[model samples]
Target: MTYLNGVQVSSAAVSTDPLSWLDERASERTDAGLRRHLRVREPESPAIDLASNDYLGLVRHPEVIEGAIAAVRRWGAGATGSRLVTGTTADHALLETELAEFVGAQSGLVFASGYAANLGAVTALAGRGALVVSDAGSHASLVDACRLSRARVEIAAHRDVAAVERLLAERTEERALVLTDSVFSADGDLAPLTELHRACRAHGAVLVVDEAHGLGVRGDGGRGLVHEQGLAGEPDIVITATLSKAFAAQGGVVLADARIRAHLIDAARTFIFDTGLAPAAVGAARAALGLLRRDPTMATRVLDRAADIARIAGVAEPDSAVVSVVLGEAQLAFDAAQTCRARGLDVGCFRPPSVPTGTSRLRLTARANLTTAELDVIAEVLSEVLADARGTERISA
Candidate 1:
């Protein structure tokens, strides 16, 4: 047996070399101008700052900063342990209670990230033989959750209620879940939650909504999309949100029926094994929520700013705080982003994998704190950049 093992090991040993396929892929990305690079900038830099997801512009708000500082001073910087162990701080509990009340849910659970919360919700709520009917354009986190759940996943066309109904009808199983995003991250389109809820009821399936982009930007006082659609208190509904965006905090949450929330407290691996959110983030989120409740005008201002940006671009009409300016090719999109950056305007450059349907675009997000003068400058620069790119078919920068 040892001699045979030795011969097999010798045969399996191969020289260390780069895979040809990987090299080809790298070359393909370079040639198509779709290669991604990161830029480091100081927080105080004088950039136009259209790239970040600070919808309400609360990241720099004094209240939010003070809340974070107070929490850290009181509870320390780290969570120190998992929730099931020693990580469940007083701040976490307070944040959960407030978040659930704000979103009209019976209860809520906090997680380290929006992605982790999505995974915990999707994977724990469904299992093998369970049916998961998902939107084709749902976020990658939810997609990966479905894959990890090992359930029979049937992807319906994006926002197609009839297709979801058809899939639910054809299935022989009784256990099923329908998942979608409240507002799509790429194009800022909203899902038809009313139609989806009605279909799910008819099919006896649970509905899960990811409100990552909708929270702090939709509904009454930015309670989120589910609240805006009047589905917040549904008995069979579940919603997930990221605090990092509009909340200007640093955590994620899973909101659901009381029973499901209890189940997650016991069974969700992401919650059980991962350390709880830091006290600073929890406190910051609480403070942000309070600020939103007090100042509803913040939501309106940012949404209006996003609309103005779309009108100036004349390419993509934004439905929410995100506006995507379409560029025909990947290289042009990257170059346009660089040009915008050179002009001290930072924006997101999205290509094949990040965008839906292989569309390349410049993604701009609006903030409530940006002055009208700043926006006008951004508009002028962007219009000039687009005109130059359209005329020359490339950004000279």
Candidate 2:
């Protein structure tokens, strides 16, 4: 008790100051016209929606909604604990089982989100001595997962199998994990997954493919890119997907061999520590999957819509359900988005940090449920917006 009260402080509270660092960051973003904002939208709003990831348009299906409502009623409002504890419900198990079977995997594990699933898969599989070969154009979540895994990461050029093969040949490490996205999110371009898989096999490395955008847009009956590439049941390949995108629900899943699934269930900290996906999401996704299995037309419709958007908007030919309309500068991109908004259309605006500098574009994700008339309206509004934005840019310059 040597003078314990000597350092007693005053009772008055310290003044709260706004963080200047954050203000500066915000100012920089604003100056670059890259500031983002959220708009409240209603279910049946007249605004044409091309900014969402619901490519298959299953979010508002009667069956999907009913499944969500029923699951909430049956399993309560929330998952009460971590999946390892009291959170895992029958719905979750059913979804996992059905997903594995549909995707031709030996087993599957579900996670709270796609980002979490990627983290869990990457960190668990690629350990301290392992090397992770990633594509430079991969999703941010996958890049973060690689960085967090404490493994040596070599980012090859986008879809460059030759570069990957060269890196793998040079690496002395015996173990490597090659990661790529089946469909690049920003540009909606498909990776040469078949070629990558061959390279992975030649190098004796495991392949981790993120099927986030391809699940309901590619493959036979929406099984996914891996299925299309004939790698679905391969022991050296694993696939990760998000229920939120095509399924219009909230969850992530990893499909792989039975042994790897077991390892994830036991060793993946993200799975152990995070709360399980909601019962409603599980049910909704299950329903959506079932519908996709039965209808199959949903997938084709989405592809058609994406191609239509590209042709009508006079943009680069789309490879999938995402069409990007190039805008020269960040301010022009922002103005184009605003112009579309004013004309009762909703579209995604990509600028620096998201897209590379000087390559700003309007990222439009088309949905299957959108009609031809709606597409016509979208094209008209977008054309007008781009023209107006260009005029404004010329005036400013």
Candidate 3:
């Protein structure tokens, strides 16, 4: 027997046809209601969008558009090369400075995407001899980072500070890193930042918080939950955030102590090897940051919208802009999403691997600019679909 992509197969079976096993896997997925396909969205969509991560609705703001255009005109389309090479432009430096200052960090380093930033930070900070205590509910990028770090990993119970502290206290390794998401992506719940940080401090471990979902929707004026908890700029705490979400740009950043920043510059392969973030993305993010500074009310508006969505969907109040409605079966979630689309609403359906085995759900994002009419439309569509789902369940029972 041999392992092929984690599935064990007899050598004889593999020798017959190397690609034949894919057909069986495909059939299994089809039967499980786990098959997925991509659809192209219209450029001028008529649907009320509740699927995107543009929490602040700055993607098309006039200043954001002008920032992209100006960057293209001044710095060309791309960063030209990796940051270590010729990709580090003046815009990149300026953006880094502004991001560090805005997030209350001593320094910052930009990466191609949030995934890369997480991977770079985790791997660079926790290596083969270190112990990595990770939250079980962390984003996939962080999970992958732990794997790549080749460290002794301990997955603490989700949001359980006691479990994390236990792991940290029992670990034999002197160097340890605790990893978690500030705002969980699927259920939109928040981590206990204060308790987690306290535990890390007690154990003398560094805490790495991914603020991808928290940066644009939490804290005072969206400085982020870390800043809100007075953990920003702490020597033992590091933050990794995505520019693609609230910033409405396309990159990632690691904000940390100045010493950590220098370490990542020298050790993080993702930053050293990947091409620098596009010039347009850097410019757009900078512009969005400026807008947020000018209009702090946008952050509050997004949370209010999320609360409205949760009330309409009859789910728990959201901790962030993401409101998830659990629908049980994958097929039910897919059908409900399609029904909403038919009613001129665009929402996300997350099944199987994206969520836990039994919690297929409708993932809705609250945008700052979503109007009352759009909220009403969403509520109406959701109510009808949920009623139908219940009816089907009763009949099946």
Candidate 4:
């Protein structure tokens, strides 16, 4: 065995034994009830979907399905290369234009996934010489982006505008970025975008808002919270969103000024190196966007369902379509999720490190298409789960 950074390493059996620490971690996770296994979902499964991000329930819309099929027939199965090469199709350009126009942005750039979009935006915009002030409740993607940014990063208390303002005002770097989520995933709460933008303007800092959970569930006609706040056209504010969440597709986009878009095309490493967003996803997203534009009422229906869910779950109605039920302890949340599944409901189970310790939760997302019968079933199952969990529940919902 050889020593490397105080760790033992050997050439023979290195492929297997070198990763033995992973086994120990797995054992620890199992002991703590943190071990997770993927559940196979058949296309025709009968389970009620309260866990997916399909806020409008458009994933199975005929038009969206046809859009994907048409795209595949026309563009083949994939993009074939990065956008800088042969991957930028006319479909890509059109979708980008429509998305930018929908959110009132000067331009838009698509990425393979929302995670990549966040990574590209943060890394390209903020680097070693800059500062990044992030909300404590930001998604993992944004947190990872801040790390990849190589900037001096600070975490303000969740929804603490004053702390964020102070961080921006006190930063020594010539450039700074204020990062936040329009709709926080875990708690399903809205951020103070207007106030954050004001502070950013006062301190000459850029504001980046991830609207992954906001785009199809907030604002009139589902234009997103940024648009609702009348900040869509602001040059200093950047918006990143996932097509998958609301659009029922499989990609991400950065909506910004034409200049910023140009810079990202040139400097965003993720965009430059990663294979372009698939054509089928572009087609599906475009179809979903068209549906949203034509039937703006879908957004309202989603929120209404969300409110119903909150009322049934005995929690406050959320700002978006997410209804979160905190069940505390990892095992408790796991059991509740399993119970829900057994009752024909599929709900999200968020535990530590996804959430803070002692704050494991069952995250339920509302869908525009969820029937009244489904809601009643949810009430039947969830009420029992929560009441039972109360015996051991530590954190409050």
Clashes of 3: 0
Query: Which lDDT tens digits does candidate 2 get at residues 189-265?
Result: 99998888898999899999999999988888888889988888999999999999999999899999989998998
lDDT of each: 0.88, 0.88, 0.92, 0.93
Q: What is the TM-score of candidate 3?
A: 0.95
Error of 4 at 95 (Å): 0.8
lDDT of 1 by residue, 1-397 (tens): 2234356445344435648668888888898776777667886988888899999999989999999999999999989989889858877888889999999999999999999999999989898878999998899999999999878999999999999999999988768999999999988899999999999998899999999999988888888889998898898899998999999998899998989988988888999999888889988988999999899888888888898888777755676899988786888888899999999899988888887534788999988788988878887788788888678443222
Q: Considering summed lDDT, which 10 consecutive residues are worst modelled in model 1?
A: 1-10
> Candidate 4, residues 101-164: lDDT per residue as tens digits?
9998999999999999999999999999899999999999999999899999999999999999
Please list all clashing residue pairs in model 2, or write none if there are none. none
Model 1 stretches with alpha carbons more than 4 Å out: 1-15, 18-22, 356-358, 392-397
With candidate 4 superimposed using the best TM-score fit, by how many Å does residue 141's alpha carbon deviate from the native?
0.7
Candidate scoring better on lDDT of 2 and 4: 4
146-181: candidate 3 lDDT, tens digit per residue: 999989999999999999999998999989999999
Q: Candidate 2 vs candidate 3: which has greater TM-score?
A: 3
Candidate 3, residue 11: how far the Cα is off, in Å:
10
Candidate achieving the largest lDDT: 4
lDDT computed for candidate 1: 0.88
